[model samples]
Target: MPTTKKESLQFGLMMCFGMVLFMTIYNLFLSGFIEAITLMEVIKEFIIGFLIALTLDIFLVGPGVKKIVSKLPIDKSKKINMVLAMSTLMVLAMALFMSVFGLAISYLHNGNEDNSLLKDYFSTFLKNFIVAYPLQLIVMGPLVRYLFIKFVLKIKCNCNEY
Candidate 1:
């Protein structure tokens, strides 16, 4: 429930970071431990994942979250409530949009053309949604918002007076 473009951008940035971090952990847990021979590869994955996530966040999730929030019966005056609602909605939106994209990424990474993404897609989606919803709702959302509110949004630095 961002009322301004700046807030929307800030929210998107937060999600972008959260997604990149989450995806890195997911990717590592899936296959990186055995496959990665060096830390450089992990760093590369992180950078590439960050770029991909930022693009997806700004292009897909950010606007979609705003649209979904707009449809919900939310109280704009209640910041905490709005944050919770938006975080929940964002998790749903991410699950809906990013799951397939994640499948594609996995497909590319694994070089598995024989196995269809359709197979076990539901199970994968459910697992991802279940894991991500709690992480987003309980950890990343509040942490990011708290940091933004405490240090970024509420701070104003003015110098060199007239």
Candidate 2:
């Protein structure tokens, strides 16, 4: 979604905010939030997740997807179609990386390490990706992109014009 470092940073910040919110709620839900999740816990998760999301998206996945997606035989003449395609790719890439970040945060929070770290982490990644993909594509992705386009970048795309 971002072609430059400055845009990437802004995009990353938006994504980090959205994703951390989603993951915090999802993780707590899985752990049975009925047991009471604390404000401090949420804060910690947000901090760690934000850092991970920002770093991974900006440096690794964001640029990689840009190059790869640009080569795809998509109907790029239409901005809406291009945006949708990019959003899908971004979600998938972000989910993949979320596995590593989730595992680390879980370990840090609980201070409990699994013997089968690799296996467990892979499983965690897969589960997270499944849920995150849809949430990003349908909700957070568009919202963040819109905000970026309007407020941050302030560039109105001509995609909707014939």
TM-score against truth, every candidate: 0.76, 0.77
lDDT of 2 by residue, 1-162 (tens): 566777778778887798778887787676555256678877877787788778777788877888887999988899877777777787777777777777776676565554588787778777887888788878887898889888766553454343
Candidate 2 residue pairs that clash: none
Clashes of 2: 0
Error of 2 at 108 (Å): 3.9
- What TM-score quantifies how close candidate 1 is to the native fold? 0.76
Taken over the whole model, the C-alpha lDDT of each candidate is: 0.69, 0.76
* Position 50, candidate 2: lDDT: 81
Candidate 1 lDDT, 92-128, residue by residue in tens: 7767666666666566566666766577466557767
